[model samples]
Structures are given as C-alpha cells and as structure tokens.
Target: MANHELLKLTANQVKKGNYNKAILAIGSCEAHGLHLPEGTDTLVSYKLSCMVADRVDGLLVLPPVTVGYSGHYDTFPFTITLAYDTVIQVIYDILESVLRNGINRIFLMNGHDGNIAPIEIAARKIKEKYPDARIAALPQWWVTAGELLPPDTFEVWNGLGHGGEGETSIVYYLFPEWCEKELATCVVPDHLPDKIEIKWDFAELTNTGNTGDATKATVEKGEKMTKVLVDCVVDAIKKLDAVNWDYSSTNAASKL
Candidate 1:
C-alpha cells in the first residue's frame, strides 16, 4: 500500500520512499473509434504504469505525456498532434528532468504507435548524455500482449489496429464507462500485405477511424490482457532490480 505515484506523493513521502526507479507512460490523444474515448491511449498506458508501479518496490510512476504525435490520425475529429521534433523534445525534457531527480533507472511505457520513433530518439539522446542511466522500454504493449497470450485469444486481425479488438477490450476492462460498446465497429485492411510495412494514413486504413474487429472485444479478454501486460512489466523490473540495473557485460567482465 506504499505510495508510488510521484504526482500523488508529498515531497517528504517521496524522500522517505527513496525510489530509485521510475516509469513514464507516453501516450496520444486521438480518435480511437466511435466506441472508445479520445484519451484511450493515455488512459490505458497511464493505468498500466500505475499497475506496474503498484507491484514493483521503489518504483515511482511519473505523470504521463498525455498528448503525442497523432498526425496520421488527424483525418478524424479532435486529434491532438505534435510535430515529430516537438514530441522528441518533450520526451527528452521529461527524461532529463527525471534524471535530474537522481532516478536513473527509467522505464518508458508507450501506448500509441505514432510516438514510437520520437520515444526512441528521446531515449537515445538521454543515453548519449547520461551513459550510466539504465533505461528500458515497452514501446509496443499491444504487440507484446498478443505475443504473450495464446494465438486464439483474439478473434480478429490478431487483435491488431487502432481502437481494435485488443485495444477496445483493455479499455473496456479498465474504463468500461468510457466505452460505448453499442457503437463499436471495425474495418480490417485485407489489401495490405502481411510482410511489408505500409506507412498509410488512418484515413486510408479505415473510414471508421478503427481497423480491427472491435465487435469481438470483451471484458474477459481485456482482463486477461491487463494481467499479462502488468505481469510482464513487473517481472522485467524485478529482474533489472536484481542486478541493481547493471546489465553491462563490460561491468561484469571487470568483476571477473
């Protein structure tokens, strides 16, 4: 029952807690679909970050970056998009601030696909400046969830796509009130090749602002996804803590 959220803790509590690691959720504000909320990405990532922090000792959950680059999804209404460089700078600044607070073991939990490149760029910049900083990231939780679960867990497009079955299911489990299940819909892009990566806009993929079989989503699937994702992060953090966040073979070789 220890307080792990930086935003919720007092300075005295934080000092007493002596947290050495932190998590920052990077998410986007965009149209998930007619059924899901606009802040679906942020809500999901932030909630997962909280879940991870709750189980990990000495781990602090920092305030999330709620709005990320969503230019591709701007064809839909009310999408907040940041320029690529701006997104990079924002993430860099946040990470820099976290490092300044003396917590160098950082974990980034990202929720939107558009922010992936920016997160990488920002993390690289932080590493270049602070080589001792041990940073880890779950850049694509959606993909990770699918990989962790059984193949048949999701009934459509492998639970892939914006506001798709997997995404909707998780939201439904975590924030069911935000979802209008009656309005849920999907548009699986059958034309796109399986092997090649296509940089298509959201408009090109689906007219409904979603690209998966959302109707197949359910609370049970969401609950399962949440557990696996949280467990995955918690286990990884414990492993990192076991070595004092020192995974460098060079350091190990020196001891040898």
Candidate 2:
C-alpha cells in the first residue's frame, strides 16, 4: 500500500486517468548550512511527501520540484529563486494541465519557506477556474518544529539552529549517512540583526550558515516529530473535508 509506483505517472498517463488525487512538492536549492547539502529542501520534500501519501488514501505523490525560490538566499551562490508571479503562472499552468485529465483535486506540499505567496496565488486562481477544486500546501517544517521544540530555551545556540537541529534531524532520520554528525558542530550566529524585509540570504545570518543549535538534534527526536506532524496532517485533512460550509449561510457573495 505504501508503494508509489502505481500512484504517480507521466503527464501522458495522468491525462488518461492513471493517477488519483495529486500532490506537487515545491522545494528549493539553497544553502542549508555547511553541515548539510544544498539539496536539503528537495530531499526533504520528496521524503515527507512520500510519508504523507502513504497515510492518505487516493493520494498520488508527484515528483518534487527540486528548484524553487531562494531570493532571500541569493547572496549565497547556490541559491536559486523564481519571481513570485512567474512561479504562480507555472503552478497555475500545471493545475490546468492536470484538470484537463479529469482530476480536480490537488495539493502542494511546500518545502521551501519562500514559496508560500506564489503557491497560494496559484491555488486561488485554480479554484476560480473549477469551483470544486480543493488545493492546499504546507511547508512541513512549520508543523514539526512548532509542535516538538519547546519555546523556552537558555541556548542562544538553539536560536541559530533551524538548519542545524530541526532540519538536520529530519534528514538524519530519512538518510542517515547523508546526515553528518561531525558537521553538527557548525556555529550559530547570535549578533546578526533582523531586517524589516525577509532576509533571503543565508550568509547574512551567519558565516557558518547555520540558524539553530543543531548539536541538540537527534534521530530519536526526529522520529517523534515526524510522527506528530503526520498525525496532525491526517487530522486536518479529515476535518477540512467535513467542514461542509453552507454557501447560502452568509450573503457575502451576494453583496459582491
């Protein structure tokens, strides 16, 4: 039942109904930290999407988009980004193509933090085209880190730790060898000032390119966090499906 071999197909087969409910994993190729590879977002998206697909029935996990927005990290050489409008068009075009195949349901599993705006725009436009369309996306880190990591901390090291601890642990659990424990010692910057605009540049935050105290991360913690996130997602999907709002309840549309 966990096999995705039969779930995702080529555009040709998808047009022929060879798939079911669809997912598009949006990720980025940006500097994660000196400890982790630049491909961290892509790798994580693929693994997490597969985990989600296994839990939900009729979910067809699409191959992840390895390249996504990294304008904030553009100062770092490897980082790449797409303009918000351009990405919106790309996603909209994709949904349109999928809809042509008679599949009306779609979800975007966002891996990069910066992909949010464009993805939402695409969702809104797609819904306008097909009233029955159900579209959603979430960057899994928001769910996992928010739940597991306690807020109170004496460690400023922890403050520098996003890529260091939370992200590294998730990767370690999924691909052990690729997770370098030695590199876990990367320095987390404390004196960097927060700017009004979103700082897309990883190097600006720290010379070592780490945000969190990754030394605290462990495989055990990752396993627990992953379970919690998957459970929450499953619950959310059920609740949303049952929301059954009466369109006539409020004349908000009529006022328009």
Candidate 3:
C-alpha cells in the first residue's frame, strides 16, 4: 500500500531523489507443503521488503525475483529451479543495473534458502567491479525470523523449517486467505546421531513435503512474529544506511 514499490514510480518521481538505497527481494516458487501456497517465499520476501522500505529513509523496494534455485525439491511437483550459474548471473545483472543508475546501496533480501549462496556470490562480484558499492544479502526468514522469536516459542526445528510453525504462522497473520489451516501437517525427519548429514530429494525427506510442526502454529503467534521481524528489518536498514562506505579512492590515497 505504501509508495515503496519502485515499479509503480514514474521517471520524474524517481528523479526527485531521496531514494539512495534499493532492496531486491529474491525468493523461490516451490512446494511449501500442503497447507502453504507455492509462492510463500516470494510473498514473504516482498512483504518484508515493503515493510522495511516504508519505514527507512531513502529506501526503495524493487519488484521481487520470484523464481529461484529449488533443485532439492525436484521430487515435488510444481517446483521451479534455475542453474546455480544462472542464478548468480541474474543477481549480478540486476545489481549492476541498479548500481549504474546511482543506487549504490543495495540489499538483497533472500526468502529462499537455496538462493543464499548465489546472492552472496553475486554481491562479491559486484564489489569487485564497484569498490564504492555497498551490498548485502540478508537471509530474512531463515536466520532473522527465528532469532526474533522467543527461545521457548517453538521446538528446535519447528521455528526454522520449510512450511513449519514460523512460515505457517507468518502466512496466517499476513494472508489468512492463502493459509489452509485445516490441511496443516507436520513431517520432521529423523535425526542422525554424531552430527551425520544426509541429503536427499523432497520425497526422500518427507512424504508431506513439510518439515517441523505446522499443527503447533497459530495466528496469534504469527502476528507477534511479524511485528518483531518488521521492526528488526527497519532497524537493520537504518543502521546499515548510516555506516560509511567510502572504501574506494580513500583507501588508495592512504596507500599512496
């Protein structure tokens, strides 16, 4: 609802200035169990970006990159994925475009876990090209959401699982129409002792295609979680904006 979306802004409005920081919300379109919608990651990323951009000064929210790498969920129907190299190139191009337009402060708010590495790789490449550019890739829902929640609020894995308590609760509060509460199901995988790691397709992990406890999710918890996450986002964006990023010719001058 706020005027944070850059796509809706006119060229004259954009040239009016004040918006120096741009956020690119990156997510994936994939199976998020039976209860959650396929566009869960994209929705969350866009919503969080809007919330942050609206609250922070000189922040503009760009349209989200809805499709991301989801090869791990190949067994699940309707899951879309891009090659690792392809994703990196896509992020690089987007960043390059924005940076060239004079928006050097960039934040890639990642909603899907699979896009994390690619976003980071792209950010590194951008830094190599533009030494004055300030870029960051934040794992918005993965790390930040769980950190905002109380330790006792959810089980160990429930707070940070695919279509689990955290995500289900978020959807319930933000978009109740999209949440299928009646069909909510849980499918936590068995833990291997000695920290042994086992990787497999979606079907191999869980028939329901969900991990953690969705049954435990409630709209009330979702409301609280959303507030905390939004506040965290606003605070983080403001703090990052205030930091000095003149590590360009200034550093070279010191050497000289």
Candidate 4:
C-alpha cells in the first residue's frame, strides 16, 4: 500500500471507519551547524513517526509538522523558531483534526528538545477536550537514548542545546553524505562549569555554537538509535490497555 504514510488513501480506507490510531511527527525546520541542513529536526521526527506507523496494522500516518517551537535556537544564522503560543496552536489544531477522524489514539513523535513544552500542553489539552482520546507525546530520543549510543558519549553537560552529536548521529545514519564526520569535538561548552544554562544566546559558552560533538557522530550509532527509539514507541503502544474502564465514543469530528 505504498508505505502507510505516503499512500494516497482511496475512499475505501476512509469509509471502513478503519482508522484506530495514528502517529504524528512534531518536528522543526531550523539550522543545525555549518554542515547539516536546517530541516534536520523535522527529518528525524518524520523517520520516527513512520517507524511507529509501520507497526501495528490499524494505524494511519500524518505528515510531519515541519515548523515547531524552537526559541532556544534563534541565535544561529539560519535557525527558525515559532513563538511558544504559535507552536501550541499548531499542535492543538493538528490533534483536533485527527480526533475528528475517529482516531482515538495518538502518538506524538517528537525530535526537537524545544518542542517538549508545547507538546505537553497539546497532550493535556487533547485529553481535556476529548475525554475518550488517548494521546502520548514522547520525544523520539527519550525512549531509546540509552541503548543507542555508548555510555562514554552521553555528554550530560552540553546535550541540552541544538546541533549536537546526538542529532548529528541520527542524520548521519539516515543521510550519511550530509554529515560532517569530524565535527564532533571533545571540547565541552563553557557553560558546563556554570551548570545552570547550557543553550541559547550564551555565545561565550560554545566555541562553535554547537553543544555536543557532531564530528563524533556516526551513521552506525544513529541507525541503532533510530531503531531503538522507533521500537520503543511501537512497544509502548502495544502494551497500552484498551480504552481504560470507560466505553464511550464522543462522535465529535473536526476538519484540518
């Protein structure tokens, strides 16, 4: 059926009321480093979204949200970010659209750290509006972060920012030609000493505006990370209990 996500659904998949669940990629279009393109965030998020959608038959896939909240990355030249409120609106709008389509379950596939807040907000709001809806917003990395990379590469200090080894690794695996192999340097950000704030306009902290080492990133590691994370999300969905205690369908529908 041409990959669930890419499939141009016929009226048949539409009328069976066959839609049971869906995976939405909440990504961002912004700069990473000199080497990586601005859409790295959206790219990884989309991969995770598709991975989850491919599993568990009744799930439909939605296009990735290419623009998301990224306030922390505005200092960079090509970095693009939406205000906190605007991003919240985007998420809210998308969730409503999916809920209207008889989709009771939603998995928010997140790739950007900055997207954490708005995603959380949207999750909560989705629940409030549609009491029967089951929505989970989980960052793509949080699930398989441990299993994907070596313990030594964790780099607890500088990971809070953008365009780091973690992100680069994912991109490298998906698109090796686009990655710069030598960008991941050992030098930690200056803010490591302060230990208060690691990312943002604190230009003095970063020697290269990169939090972690992108040069150390490898396609192998990224591939492993992607698999781990994707598998984790699919596992979580399967493990979930069916419609907790209450059996009611709110027949409300929304349009995109």
What's the TM-score of each model vs. the native? 0.96, 0.79, 0.90, 0.81
Which predicted model would earn the best TM-score?
1
Error of 1 at 25 (Å): 0.5
Best candidate according to lDDT: 1
Q: Give candidate 3's whole-model lDDT.
A: 0.82
In model 3, which regions exceed 4 Å deviation? 156-158, 192-197, 245-256
Candidate 1 Cα outliers beyond 4 Å, as residue runs: 250-256
C-alpha lDDT of candidate 2 relative to the true structure: 0.67
* Per-residue accuracy of model 1 over 65-124 as CA lDDT, tens digit each: 999999999999889999999999999999999899999999999999999999999999
Ranking by TM-score: 1, 3, 4, 2
Off by over 4 Å in 4: 6-17, 140-144, 147-161, 182-187, 193-199, 202-204, 241-256
RMSD for each model, in Å, please? 2.1, 4.0, 3.1, 6.5
Error of 1 at 4 (Å): 1.5
Candidate 2 Cα errors over 4 Å, as ranges: 5-20, 148-162, 186-200, 241-256
Question: Taking the tens digit of each residue's C-alpha lDDT, what string does model 4 give over 105-223?
Answer: 88788877778888888778888988888887676464347545467644543233456666677787887776666555543554355537445453554545465666566667677
TM-score of 3: 0.90
